[model samples]
Target: MSRIAIVSDIHSNLEALVAVMRDIEAKRVKKIYCLGDLIGYGPNPNEVIDIARDNFEFVIKGNHDEAVAYKIPKRFKRLAAKAAFWTRREIKPRKRPGYREQRVRWQFVHKMPRSEQLGTWLMAHGCPTSNLEYIHDNETALQVFANEMGGSRICFLGHTHVPGIFTMDGGEVHYMEPQDGKRYAVTAERAIINVGSVGQPRDGDPRACWVLARSDGTFSFRRVKYNVDAVAERIYREKGLHTSLGDRLFVGE
Candidate 1:
């Protein structure tokens, strides 16, 4: 139960990812797990995938990951669907100098599991029941704890892009907004933690968000500031990516 770092919803933002990785390294964290959404909504799908493939311990499949890798039905909203489609075209294998490497990266995303269980903890992009499902409230967290957790004490997930802690004790659930760098002890019978988004954070904070979980039953949320303007400019230059995507990064909406 060594300390581990969890990151999610990278959304192909290379600047943010690099910044988070640097912070993780500075903290001397060894094992890193990704909750997914490795691609989509940004300018560097291939580059981001390459880093995840090379560094992460494992990456669970997210809704965007499933859509981009398989070209499945576009179930996302208008803007998200457009980004996924654009990402699909951008990451598709082509006759290039690194064709073999490109194919390997595509396969990595294709083979990602919807969920992974590690000892008493479960890791998923969204929820254990489905990758598309989001646990944004106490009711959803309670339902997941009662039905879907499958006896795990803690469930780590990301998809809402907002970092928070949900604890179920004696059939009552409580939600808390995790403050940056504060380690909250997990004393509840069951808990669900959202590690938040590395690329796109919706908690009104423009900085990247991640979590550091320790073996002592405590975890801390971390925020790292990166060059958002660099990523936004890249998105603006790419005709396939909507400008709204760039604009949201500034406000973290």
Candidate 2:
């Protein structure tokens, strides 16, 4: 009856996060784990952080979260850089009356770990070791499985915003595409699971996606539709924010 809900890349889309949480609660999951990117790209960074702090039991730091807390890497594209800078101010505005409260929220993300080990499972925003790396393809996923030294046989990750699975067996790597409502059995082969994005999905699907991992060594991907237009409209209304950020929500980029 107990299940661990794995979520990631929320990207400050409150509407999508709310819908995903609703579906997660409906499934009666006991513990929720977030793989990070709680803010960035969207309009509601503080709201997403508050929900993440309140709901998720385990949280790992994401690249966007790092960019906001620390320095934006040179590798970051223009849009992401812009969003990170905007979020930095939005969370802890210079002349805001509630600076203390905003600082607390920012500190929450700063306190998150780059990776967490839970028994046989490893959770990270990107790869197990690097929060900025993207384990989207089989080669990259296999590299992490081989390089990372940890007891966890399974690694749950996010960052590319596309849900999929990679298995390492007998030194060979294979990738699996997940289906909604279908459970895939976890084998002795080490695996890396991408839970996709809760806010902005980039796999050509606009729905919010998360992973439902049971204690019995099986997991499933779930997608839920939310009010993309509402969030997009809100993004458009916010000044100093990119309009394309709102437009991409409708297309899932």
Displacement of residue 96 (Cα, Å) in model 1 is 3.0
lDDT of 1: 0.92
Q: Write the per-residue lDDT of candidate 1 for residues 1-253, one digit (tens) a residue.
A: 5789999999999999999999999888879999989888999999999899889999999989998987556567888888998998888779988889878888898999988999999999889978898899998998999999998999999999999999998899999999999989888898999999999999999999999988787889999999999999999999889999999999998
Q: Using alpha carbons, what is the TM-score of model 2?
A: 0.96
How would you encode candidate 2's per-residue C-alpha lDDT over 1-253 as one tens digit per residue?
A: 5698999999999999999999999999999999999998899999988898889996788999899998999999998899899888889645568777787797897898888888888888888778888887878877888898367789889999999989998998999989988999978479888999999999888999999988787889999999999999989997757999888878877
Q: For candidate 2, give the lDDT.
A: 0.88
Best by lDDT: 1
Clashes of 1: 0
For each candidate, the alpha-carbon lDDT, in order, equals 0.92, 0.88
